[model samples]
Target: MGQQQDDEDREFDIKWADGAEHKEPSARARMLAARWKENPPGPVPFRGEPEGVGPRWSSWVSTAVVLGSVVAVIVLLGYVNFRAPY
Candidate 1:
């Protein structure tokens, strides 16, 4: 097990070379800022609930709630129509 862990660690090890200068993002940053000044971004897009990242019970609860509301609406409408005397 220790050997396997060592192999995994080796696989993720980073080897940085000498004398590598990190480039700045000033150019792209200025360009995006200018574009935003001209045409600002609209409302944030709605990314629906992320998959597989919440309580399993919460999903089942929401689904049951929605179905229960639909059934309740149908039953209420039927009761109302039956009592309408039309």
Candidate 2:
């Protein structure tokens, strides 16, 4: 039925907004850049993809190291409150 087809099309639009199957580059771009850019907008969401805003072994690791060091310092300070013998 016509109503059912329209519903399906609407559903597809919603899925695309949710980062589902993506669209190919346009013809106008081919004349200009001659390249089909991959996921130019943002991180393409695929199932089972772990948390990442960059490529492998990058800033995330460095940030984690710094945070770990900070926590360690806090824990160590609690063990010994600095109070000089008077």
Candidate 3:
């Protein structure tokens, strides 16, 4: 069992690269590739304000209003159901 575990953990020596000659890219390919020379693709810079930076009192007030409305509707529904004659 120990020998099997050792074999499983051992990395196999695999030859991935084929002996192929490197070819030069075409003129159009080089022209398209030149765009990245100025601005290389990478993580975007943090320009704007951090998340939730400003005062969030308005958001909290709106959330409380919505929740209170929902609770009031639920209570009204329960009261109506309780008063219904079967």
Which structure among the candidates has the greatest TM-score?
Answer: 1
What lDDT would candidate 2 get against the real structure? 0.75
Model 2 residue runs over 4 Å out of place are 1-57, 82-86
Worst lDDT window (10 residues) for model 1?
Answer: 11-20
Q: Which parts of model 3 have CA positions greater than 4 angstroms off?
A: 1-57
Stronger candidate by lDDT (2 vs 3): 3
Better of 1 and 2 by lDDT: 1
C-alpha lDDT of all candidate models, in order: 0.80, 0.75, 0.76
Which one is best on lDDT? 1
| Candidate 2 per-residue C-alpha lDDT over 1-86 given as tens digits, one digit per residue, 9 for 90 to 100 | 99999999999988877785666667887655644364345456676556675556779899999999999999788766665344
TM-score of each: 0.35, 0.29, 0.35
Residue pairs in collision within model 1: none
Clashes of each: 0, 0, 0
In what order do the candidates fall by TM-score, top score first? 1, 3, 2
Residue 9's lDDT in candidate 2: 97
Candidate 2 residue 30 Cα shift, in angstroms, is 27
- Residue 13's lDDT within candidate 1 is 58
